[model samples]
Target: MSETFVDLGFVTAPSGVVVLGMAGWIDYWREVGEPLSVRAGVAAKAGGGYLREEECEAVAVPAAADRPLAVRATTEPSMFDEEPTIATLEIELGLPWPEGVDGPVLLGDLPVDRSGMVIGDGVGLDAWTGQEDEPADGLGDVTFWGRYEEDAHARFGGERIPHPGGVDGVYGWLDVPMAEAVALEAEISTWRGGVWGQGVAGSVEPHVDYFRFRRAGLHHPLNVGAIEVGGCQVLGIDWCQGDHSVRHHGGRDWGQAFPVTLEADGTGGTVLRWTIPPYDEDEEG
Candidate 1:
């Protein structure tokens, strides 16, 4: 259970830890819903990136070190400036997808222009440095569940949604076409306020550290905030369009949403899930 497709390239600092450079290359914009065709210079190395050499069409890596895991971050928007924010850090990858496919929808492709794609870091830029020194615990009791974008409905509740479309948390992939049977729906956004359970890092730990500084999914996606003063760093995108279905809610606790079972695996690819929730808590003091 270890698929591979390496093009080699990875670097995520600011403490969210996502660095894998025996080489380099990281330009993400691969969605698959209604924006299908994104594959921006995806290359990661150190041992095996590019999903470990495509792993038979899509099995990236990590088939049984756990499950379907290959989470990523650094959704570039020039990092960030003022409005449009979301992306503190997240990497919950168990890995698995491409073995008799079953309702696999996660797509996004309609924005391609990879500036030559060469996110270099041969140990140079300090590996895309970002850890100021430890000091980011703003979002107090964080919790922003899921299921939201029907049309967004103005982000419901307390409307303040900004960034890409202000819907929060989402990646890309989904274009099913063979033996089809898809039904993938993910509109669960969360980042409740107050620097919630802060823990920015860059991982490669002990050989592999599936960092779960819980405050969101492991249990911490409820209004997290705190940490501002010239803050800037937001990048969250999610989309899934037409025919999709997946089912595997048998063991990893899918009570509060976390059950993947994508079924249609061909001309229907789209299930983008990009996240970076760490809303700045200062700036205006």
Candidate 2:
């Protein structure tokens, strides 16, 4: 059996850095009976105020090239009252061990491989806010934010996938069978959201998290050889802390599939093209 490698890309909003968690902040604001606006600012003395912490752990598996890699992370709340903070992250790919190279080099704690290496740079956060004073469905003025990195440069054994405009949220490619790809697309298309019980809050008002699919409209799925691709417009809403909320609304078109190709040894797989947005306004039907 020969070796196989798949190219993957991921993007998400940078974690929020705050002195208090969302629940605590909302409670404090309610106690004061006022709305609050917080932003990240430079601190003169680092030891006194609350310090926000974000940590992410990811593992790349050579065997599972067909499914998205699961990443686990945690962000700690600030200990003291202070300005909000933000942290930037850089994602890199670890290559295989070289043919003649003697030793190894570490890419963040993971040992490098010999296949090849490529890095995606300038991936960061983007925020979206709802209309001022207009609460949707009686929730509250909402703000939704996440990460977007432009021009992800991905290469697997000399094959490349370039994101010229930009890639939103998190995206990647795996070399699974056609049936598995279709199943994955269906799972993503039907996701509505979930509920968070008092485990994080403790009150009867459970945090309601939901996203309305086909909010903009539905885009049908496509089957091309070994690849299956599909996506639709989505409006995601999260209501916590009694009335505070966040929403993610975006438009997606049926046309245009971001193409990805995987190669290992001397064998190549069918190019898988998946739909992504920031859609072209002119191309929307």
Candidate 3:
């Protein structure tokens, strides 16, 4: 078993305009008897392309450390679109790992909390892998099975959004050691029309390389899709949010509906089951 530590920080303009918040987690594969240490900082790159270091203040202590991660001093937002400025959170491992340890690994999912922004209501995780010092130009080597957020629901001005459901956190793990030459890739497609895997009121052709995973996990939440896993074809769906109902429309007369649940079988496997409800006639498409 491995131990993981998560670090979170935020940066904003002096006026409190949020630049970005970052959350990073590292996994320790080897057993270390001593406590681990972490240090964090921030850097800024203005629209003019000049990089500058900034002062940071810690607001919250990390899970593994007594000190807070560093945050950047707020700066003015760019006046023009072309001059977009960037604030980057910098985190470093304060102590060395034991020999034969594979990580201090960082995921591309920064887990930023940019609430109230027009960029929609959620953060997205990217699939990529590389050494901390190496450029990330190649495809990811890990299998990203899926991600979920917790406590992601938000309210604006005392009114809940039409769709208030969102995830606040994600959980995943490495299924296998990564090979340097392997790249993350996957395909996605959809089928609409006629029910029961038959009849075609509409059809969606295959989308090559539409999605990729660094590892294998239950990723898709709404519909059944097939992907090649371990050289075998597997179908999976995920409704990660609890108490949420999903409707599957197949043609005009046939459809499937269910509430999803994720269960662990206690043998390092996850079981996904759908509590399908009886068909409802009043539901609008």
Candidate 4:
């Protein structure tokens, strides 16, 4: 079950290993640890960088091999840093809106009661490159993941990018229409935090890698997602965008959090399973 439109471009990793590439994009990925980098604050992702050859719309469904998978604002109020904070790291593979019309909603859970999150050390992640003065980089376990806005050549079919009044992304209405193509699955497990049993993500020795992005579905409301920093990593920007070139065996598994799953196979199609978990041990401390 593989769909298409072609030309993918956007991904990163470095905190433990998650990869998202933002914060100015000189290579990005820096912050390791400091108490959630100041309560999950580092204010990264202005334009979120990387994505060219302009081409959107993607899909996938191959199985086997596994592994893998944010925040914004960064400044603007002064006086020895009075009080400033802005962060956005979207990653929704279909949320609470799953009682019918399909199943499986565990991208990260915790929308209210799905309760469960832990991508290693409880997601506060550290060490891929942290604090040197702190201007960039925050959390991304396992090491670097790749993909950057090739220069924002944004172009995804075009027209229709309204919806924006708060709730930055992951908004669902499901009238159904934005699924022209964008599915690629192949992430059995590559976290090992809880050891394959604690909410989710508990396996290892399965890393051929496979992480795409920009697979947020539904156009009715169109608050869709796919940006692990601040905003606009191609969120229906150019609109009908497309760029899917997968091989199956996989080779990219860092920022699998921003929307990048590649497993190969063939079937009816229509599968969204992402209930991630694993990272307790006082968050590996």
How would you encode candidate 4's per-residue C-alpha lDDT over 1-285 as one tens digit per residue?
A: 112212222222223222222211111222222333222222212101122111111111111112222111112212222321111223221112313433222222111000111112112232222112222322111111112111111311112222222122211221212221111001212222223232122111111101111123223222123333321132221111111111111112322222322111123322222222221235321
Tens digit per residue, CA lDDT, model 1, 138-160 = 11121222243232334432222
Look at candidate 4 and tell me the lDDT of residue 34.
36
Model 4 per-residue lDDT at 85 = 13
RMSD (Cα, Å) of model 2: 23.8
User: In candidate 2, how many Å is residue 101 off?
Assistant: 32
Question: Candidate 3 lDDT, tens digit per residue, 73-95?
Answer: 11112222222122222322122
lDDT-based ranking: 1, 3, 4, 2
lDDT of 2 at 5: 22
Q: In candidate 1, which residue ranges exceed 4 Å CA deviation?
A: 1-99, 104-234, 237-257, 260-285
List ranges where model 4 is wrong by over 4 Å.
Answer: 5-8, 19-161, 164-285
Backbone clash tally (model 1) = 136
Off by over 4 Å in 2: 1-24, 30-36, 39-71, 74-135, 139-285
Task: Estimate the TM-score for candidate 1.
Answer: 0.17
Candidate 4 lDDT at 210 equals: 11
Per-residue accuracy of model 2 over 180-200 as CA lDDT, tens digit each? 444443343233221232111
For every model shown, the clashing-pair count is 136, 14, 15, 67
Residue runs of model 3 more than 4 Å from their true location after superposition: 1-64, 72-84, 92-98, 102-104, 108-285
Model 4, global lDDT: 0.20
